[model samples]
Target chain A: MTVAAEALAGRSARRRVRETVVTHVCLVIGVLIFAFPIYLALIGSTHTSGTIGRGDVPLLPGPDAVANYAQAWGIGGGRFMGVPAGGMLLNSLLMASLIAVGKIAISLTSAYAIAFFRFPGRMVFFWLIFITLMLPVEVRIIPTFQVMVSLGMTNSMAGLVIPLIASATATLLFRQFFLTIPDEYVEAAKIDGAGPVRFFFDVLLPLSRTNIAALFVILFIYGWNQYLWPLLIVNDRSLETIVVGLTKMIGSGDAQNEWNVIMATAVLAMVPPVGVVLLMQRWFVRGLTETEK
Target chain B: MATLTLSGVRKSFGATAVLHGVDLAVRDGEMIVVVGASGCGKSTLLRIVAGLETATAGRVMIGDQDVTALEPADRDVAMVFQNYALYPHMSVFQNMAYGLKIRGLPKPEIIRRVDEAAALLDIGGLLDRKPRQLSGGQRQRVAMGRAIVREPKLFLFDEPLSNLDAKLRVQMRAEIRRLQKRLGVTSLFVTHDQVEAMTLGDRLVVMHAGHAAQIATPMEVWERPADTYVAGFIGSPAMNFLAATLEAGGAAARLADGLVLPFADGSRAGEAGRKLTLGIRPEHLRPQTGGLRVMVELVEPLGAESLLHGRLPDGAEMTVKLAGAVHADGVLEVMPIAEALHVFDGETGRRIEPLG
Candidate 1:
């Protein structure tokens, strides 16, 4: 081996080693940034009130976690405006389920129509529905509120569930996915003597389980973490959702501010979302490329 | 198997018409192929028979029943799509058994039918495998297997081999022909490949623009095409055409090589210089010691046979099939035989009757 060639190879090896270090450093830093806040939230949920207020990092979780969670339910919050934390959790669950299920049911039917059947004004109808998506929910809040009040649904979960049932975004996404399926599958089923109803159930729906699961998880998370709409609809404390309920626990009267109780409730609220994402993680990455055919 | 008939059937999408009024009778147990270029409406006619598309105006009768208005399922027909369109979610066994299952066939019957079709297609080993797990030829076989299990009154194939590789396509084409013959099922296959049409079809229906330009046995269509369009499309390295006007003794097919084909079409006697075009198969332009002279510009030898690309005196590029090999460098002689010549009217491009 020549000295010059050895030095050249060594230099290149050194450069590659340096590059590897930099890449690993960036990856570790990115992971930390993304994960640290969730770690803090979980840790904060476990601390004693004084430890939580110190607001310094807890190297490990404190021992008062069970006590904090119980306190968050208003065993110590003074009467708490008629009902307790358990009732509020129930209310949020009902509202989110109705919204998720309703959105998927309606979206599936509309997507099937837009993707498969040819009817007069199909394109026009889709364009009209899609135009609603352009109007941000913020701009329509006034109208949405007025409709809710007129229907006597104010202060009720119905106000939160029904008005937001039609999701044009989900419909459009599902429709695009459905359109990639070959028409020949439909025709093949037809020639086999299956009618439209049978074809939709037997052929289309079974093939779309992946897309449906991905959509279900996405819409479920959106419903579970909804804030502004639920806050606006539920004025009474008992009817409050997890997010609204968590907010009212501030300055919540203790030896020190009970940040632990508030954080515990927040942690519980995060469960459904994290579960949904984990369940559909495979499909989430796959959604973009599955229709290459 | 049932005899299929179409009478005065017309189909149009808005202002664009696909299948013009046409009549055809497909004999029971006969395999007929509809061949044409991309927009020739052969697929459309097949779809109408499958009940996938409705005919704008007329009746389609299958066996003794009129099935023009019934849906595809109601009509007793099966179609194999070009893309194969095998249900990705279903296994091969399920794909073949789907139609029978839908019809409420017993479990034993469904299994037996699926097994029979799979065995026939030689895909019995792939019965449990999903479509994605199989190769292109296997998927194609599975598609045929699906259609076969149904035992429909008619089977319609729409360019089913277009997606396969060239070698596989040829092999599958032969396999499908053999299967159709063995089944002796009434079938209509649509394809753009003249070779497949010639080999698979007991009778060939040649279409152009939306019209059935010629309908006859494959040999008949090849030997005697109805017009210039049919002549050009039905043969590979397509039939050559030359332009000139009709002459007194015979029509003068003036070539670009400054030579004229003195074809024996005497119907236009004393009508010299009448606009005309001469049609000749490449094999007919013999490289003999006679007729006209053409400069051999290029030579493409295909082992046993070769193609001689040359130009006539009038500058029209021409190709001639040479027997064995020819060592002509920019020079060759070709005798355009009279009996082998097909003379057509230059204006209408229709075959001119020999007046001798």
Candidate 2:
């Protein structure tokens, strides 16, 4: 009986190892499939425009990598789009930061009020805000653009950021988190002589650090990847975000396209969002899964 | 330390009234425990004192001032919650010092008070650690430490030790009692555990259905419970109640099975033939010959002593506690000590005292 049991265990152990090997092989294949396009873009950016223009997809780097990146950084790629990639990157950074910060600040307070206070029409107001989730930027773009134009915010950073700041998704997430906080903490704070404002800044804000970090990463990427809103609202070259500017760098005619410089600009555009995710990865996972409270 | 008073304190949520009317005056430095079963309005009374819940129509006076209309922070009260409610992000020192900081105390004073509280609670080594890192007992100490540093007019503890394990609960209970006495802070503690209430409170207010049924010392409440509810609630294995009727000119009670046990204390005021309830503590029932017979069905050995659960001949369930182990499968004759008998009016459930 003991020998038979040992033989069964040995077979199961071999099966487990085989299953693990198969799973890892599948995972590596999946990673390569997803990363291949980005890897190709990286290789394409290093080559000269003439080499890419001849339609030879080089898997290796070329010597003109420095010249291509410098051109993209200083003068941009397409002739019609005169704004430098450097200026556009700065514009994108400002817009994304403003949107992320503004959304978090507004959502935190609004969610706090909704969760903690007993005001009339509170749920009504929450539902009103929630209803807007169904009407995304694309659904109400024309009216939003008209409002921006009437407010004289067109062709400015405000137009690019302010319209996207009121995020219902973030407010809902924060409200759910705030509701999970035990009423004992609120009572304890009150007994400790902390008023509503003091409690918000001292207790509520510190406890929400992880949630804020998680939301900031997601919202920053949301703001950074905005293509349509910035394209329509900002006509000035100075306010052109890199996402919209990158598309403009690729001209209509095949010969007119500066493929190498455009690829370099695309790579530059990916840096901030990727860096944000990497920096905030720990807090992001923790916030979504567990609450410090 | 200050006196706490509640006059005609009533609370209602919409149509459901939780506390009909509760009046309690706690002396300075007195630890009064309000204890009852769940939903008995003991917690509601504590919250009213803390200003966490507004009394429907009453006045709450802390020391010389009426604080009924004031917010919880302005009430000069500190509460230790059941879950401890320690700020998870803050270290132990910060949690203890938070109230003082909010009150705008000078930095040095705040540090001194927190350090003093930390030492008193024996948590000096854990001041730098966050609440999550501490064990159940340490967290309990931190919660008490937070309450101590405030030096508030009143301390409100809302079932603070219910979250600990059994052995730790007993240890913390003793520590809390010692600390409260040393600090001499007027406190109102609420709990459902009878043992906790008995050991901790200088005076216990036994609440039943939103009413303070009896208010007295633990021994007084034990020996002379004001009503059947208090009599049954304060004792473990509960005081076994037997239906009886006043007889022999209110000097004795006749059980349903025709056993007439004469009162050794004194004669009651009730007229003859009046329905009455006779309460006998489990330990007070002695096994003897020529006594009330009980059929022993289950025996629970509790180490030094054992509890015998059986039924009387009249079909009323009774429990008897006897010293040492007794293996009895048949009927056991147990007699109630005449001096330990408690008589209550059957209809009203109120104790019937002897006539003067």
TM-score (chain B only), all candidates: 0.94, 0.99
Docking quality of model 1: it rates as medium
Tens-digit lDDT string for candidate 2 (A24-109): 99999999999999988888889988898898799988788898889888988875446789999999999999999999999999
- Model 1 residue B21 CA deviation (Å) reads 1.9
The local lDDT score (0 to 100) that residue A94 gets in candidate 1 is 77
Native contact fraction of candidate 1? Answer: 0.88
Clashing pairs in 2: none
Candidate topping DockQ: 2
What digit string (tens of lDDT, one per residue) describes model 1 on residues B1-356? Answer: 89999999899999999988978999999999999999999999999999999999999999999999998888878889999888888888988888888899999999998889988989988989989999999999999998898898898999999999999999999999899889888999999999999999999999998889988999998887888998999887888888766545554555544556665534554466777777889888776765556788988999888988888666777788878987778667788777778777778777776655
Q: Which candidate is the best by TM-score?
A: 2
Put down candidate 1 lDDT per residue, A132-203, tens digits, no spaces.
899866778889998899989998777888887889988998798787787888888888888878888878
**Candidate 2 interface RMSD value:** 0.7
What TM-score does structure 1 among the candidates reach?
0.91
In model 2, where do residues sit more than 4 Å from their true spots?
A79-81
**Which runs of model 1 end up more than 4 angstroms from their true locations?**
A1-15, A54-59, A70-91, A154-157, A235-239, A252-256, B244-275
